[model samples]
Target chain A: MASLLKKLGSFAAGATLLFAASAALAKPLTVGFAQTGAESAWRTANTNSMKSEAEKRGINLKFADGQGKQENQIRAVRTFVTQGVDAIVLAPIVETGWEPVLREAKRAKIPVVIMDRKVQTSDESLYACFIGSDFYKEGAMAAEWIAKNAGSRSKIVELQGTPGSAAANERRKAFADELAKNPALKIIDSQSGDFRRSGGKEVMEAFLKKHGKDIEIVYAHNDDMALGAIQAIEEAGLKPGKDILIVSIDAIKEGVQAVVDGKINAVVECNPLFGPKIYDTIAKIKAGEPVERSSYNVDIVIDSTNAAALIGQRQY
Target chain B: MSKSKSLSPVWWPLIGLAVLVAVNLALNPAFLNVTVLDGRLYGLPIDILNQGARGLVLALGMTLVIATGGVDLSVGSVMAAAGALAAVLLAEGHGLAVALTAGLGVGLLAGAANGLLVARFGIQPIVATLILMVVGRGAAQLMTNGEVVVIKNDAFAFVGNGTVFGFPFAPLLAIALFVAAQLFLRRTASGLFIEAVGDNETAARFAGLGAARVKGLVYVICGLCAGLAGLMAAANIRAADSYRMGENMELDAIFAVVVGGTALTGGRFLLLGSFIGALLLQTLTTTMYNLGVPPAVAPVPKAVLILVVCLLQSEHARRWAVSLVKGGKK
Candidate 1:
């Protein structure tokens, strides 16, 4: 028993010395972030925020811009895997084609934190936590604002974002769900604006030509489209906020400005500032603390009344 | 002597444009409009002009390249590189003239690289430009470290978004380039040499024309056009997102050239036809979006329209349609 105690004491001292040495030589956490390309101002800001936050935290961030291509993103993720990063952050371009790659990350025991966008995988174990605005809630907020302001009987035109995108899919589904509650609230015309200002304007112009007086409201998936729709409405000799009420997601500064200027009636904010929250999660995971598998409910609705005040504080 | 039974290429694309316009007008009469013109100059019609301007500029240079029996797939990458360079320079507080000059110079250098590879090494133009197409974007991305460089200079902004006598500067630039190219090609011996080289490089060389020099210069001109278009696009948005800079632009330029009645196999060039083709393409996209088609589904109608136009332009398809009409009448 005495000999066992002596061995135990020596082992304890050895472990203590090893721990002290490790603490002394502790390197900054290395993170691999595979970002979707700067397709929008929000995306650009997201990337900048990540880099700045990483710098502030003294974490080594190995970054890759996927340029909105799936193949490039896959390659980036595999590269991160090969680099043996402690954790991986992916702002996925699309949702469906991620299972195989994510499985690979899981096999490697690398914790993945999904940022800004969500993946549609059946296995929840593949990712640690998804940090993003609830896209469905955002879409529903836009729909609810439209219903309240434009009346249930108002005819609406929807300008969707890119097809097959998780945000676009969820936003569309949620808006459709909300619209189902009010039978008189009909979508007379709907088109994909491809999440671009020019695309939105072009489509809105077509909607104006085809639907004419039928379109009483424009429910855009994002503010850029709403802004474009406003231009189309104005060009068609109709007042945008007055004649055709507009509600959209993504309360970007320009979108807020549009609301304040009375061009768009309301905007549902999909907060692009996920840096602080993401860094906190990463730190928590590194410390072997419990982290939620899903982070939900990060969205706000800004309207004409509050738009002016919030525009100054808006980051993206 | 019997006239050569060659097809008049211009006849087909014009007919196709006419049919598309007719269909669009029939579907929605508001499509045919100049009413809002100057009043809502930043409206949907203006957006169409913006999208077409880049394609128009690229097509102009592509016309010369195609006339020399060569293709430059690197035009899009060249645009990205130029935009990246301009953004970096402007971000560093360089003067507008210096930034513009440097941007053009970079474009010229990239073009020269393509010209050298093709002229000196006798590499296939497609293969030569393809290498740059893949790597040039990477170089541009590297220049910005894959970050967007937003600019706030009013003078530079005017080049893209500013209005000149109530017209957007981009379209104006495109028109100016078109006019210059028209004058150069119609009234110059260089134009004849280009045609000669495209028609038969051996014959042109035998006739004492400097075929290599003409070919090299055409690519340089193509590069300049792409570079200018890139600068305009970056300035218009007041930001340079390298990833999206000139993405898939080469396809649009090629489509414009093909739809403009420029033969893909080379020989002849058409400045007016290419401009019109660009305009028509933009108009079609704008019209389709306006017609309540979902964004995901917008490409479908565009593809269908292109197919219809292609079929209508084909002598075989036209002959088939005529025979069916005749049989029905009998």
Candidate 2:
């Protein structure tokens, strides 16, 4: 009878400890994600990264694909608000018409996190903050590299992205700004590639035909165009990395591999995996900590040295 | 037909091509420079031919389809889907033949679906093909799992990037297909039937021509050509970019056919004229890049080219121009 009572008391104590441990673990935060549809590989990688990060952090992510439409995003935001989510993450397809919906979320008192794109609002208090990769800085970095590594009196051929696009405009202006500081640097020919491999190749071929030996370097806006120009340069009997120094942005797998192989000189990183940082921001905002109006993702430059080590982690 | 009428629309595209080439020459005297480097013919003109090959292939089927009183808006999607399918197959270590067949087969199936709806069920060609167009893009995304499928295959890459007699195999394939199509339409009675069906559907039905079947067959042909285009595109890059590949190609093909002087309402089609039209479009693109034209307004030149070609081919413009020439003589 005494042994039975002692055993029962010990079991009760263990059960009490288990209950306390269970109570100590906090419930996972519920976040609703309104993603711009999978329009490209970069976007797909982004979506995957978000999903995996959410799972790792134990955040319940409510994902909604906007299919690259503004109206779809609006509807999605409304639905997330209805679900009473703790936080909302939006990767808007465009930069306009987000005010009305954002005001609604603000009225609901749900903290909203903007990802990948900016929303122009007269009122800054409508959302938490905007987090995205900086296009201007990426281009500026490329230009800085060129100004230092490129030989004096280098005739640069630029493969611009689609004209009028934010990426294209910002990258072009920032690159031009850097080149303005150096009298030896000159962009001989600049044309839009529409951000495609084929477009890049056609434009590069034309530049090769027109400029010939006058072109000593290529500054393509992206890796795909850089790769295409490399093909054109090879066809023209000019070595890309040797005769003409090549520089491009975006450290996608193929581009990084080329860097490791010595075909391309440098690539600037635009990290797509924003899940951990996104939720971290949410946690901070929820805890009443002050946050910046805009959070910029770090764009790291990769050359032959770090490219081999970093190639395995490339998602695209 | 009178000599001017016979030469009217045909010679105009040739004239446009000559003018563009001349412009390129004046802009850069090296435009005509050709060298045999690494056993392959390398030049600006060869690049134009190779780049124009996709448009050339698409225009061929589009010409036939328009001749049969049909228009296909799904060629772009089909091209994307075919490329995606080939990339998937090649990346999985499948044989080149199997991958090509599967890619082309998807094109055939998509075309057949378009055909069955239009020919068998009497649906509008545009609507039927549009259904496939939207679906094919989505399917392409699904097939590649929304990722780029890059293949490292030499044999498959040769289909897109290889050269024959120092000329790109893509253009050779396009030329061979163009000639074969031209002969098939001119030599065979089936060609006349297709033209008849396009000219007068009801009258042709009374004349016992299978209008639906002809319309269906043309869409299938369009699909097949789009499929081949997709394969070459994937092979060229050794990867399938479903989102980007074959994008806006359908419009380009339609533009090529229209610039070639084919009446959209249906009837006689021109192969060589369409070929020249394709060449003109590609050359204009090359010229724009060399001139350092912004990509945003680059299409302005192409739009202007189309406008000029269409106006020059129009009956009223032709009459006015001829009268002006006569007035000058007087």
Best by DockQ: 2
iRMSD (1 decimal) for each model = 4.6, 1.6
* lDDT score, candidate 1, position A66: 94
lDDT of 2 by residue, B1-330 (tens): 235665757777888888888887887777878888899987788888888888999999898888888899999999999999988988888999999999899889988999999899999888988999899999999999987778788899888889988889999999999989889889998788888988998888899888888888988998999999999888876778888889989999988888888888998888888888888888888888766677777888878877888887787888888888889999
- The DockQ of each candidate is 0.29, 0.58
**Candidate 1 clash pair list:** A192-B294, A192-B295, A206-B290, A207-B290
Give the CA lDDT, 0 to 100, for residue A28 in model 1.
Answer: 74
- Fnat of every candidate, listed in order: 0.45, 0.79
Candidate 1 lDDT over A2-24, as tens digits, reads 99999999999999998898678
Q: Can you tell me which runs of candidate 2 are displaced by over 4 Å?
A: A1-25, B1-3, B321-330
Give each model's whole-structure lDDT. Answer: 0.80, 0.87
lDDT, candidate 2, A38-122, per-residue tens: 9877788899989999988888999999998989999999999999999999998888889988999999999999998898889
Give Cα distance to truth, residue A60, candidate 1, Å: 5.5
* Cα-based lDDT at residue B312, candidate 2: 74
* Leading candidate by TM-score: 2
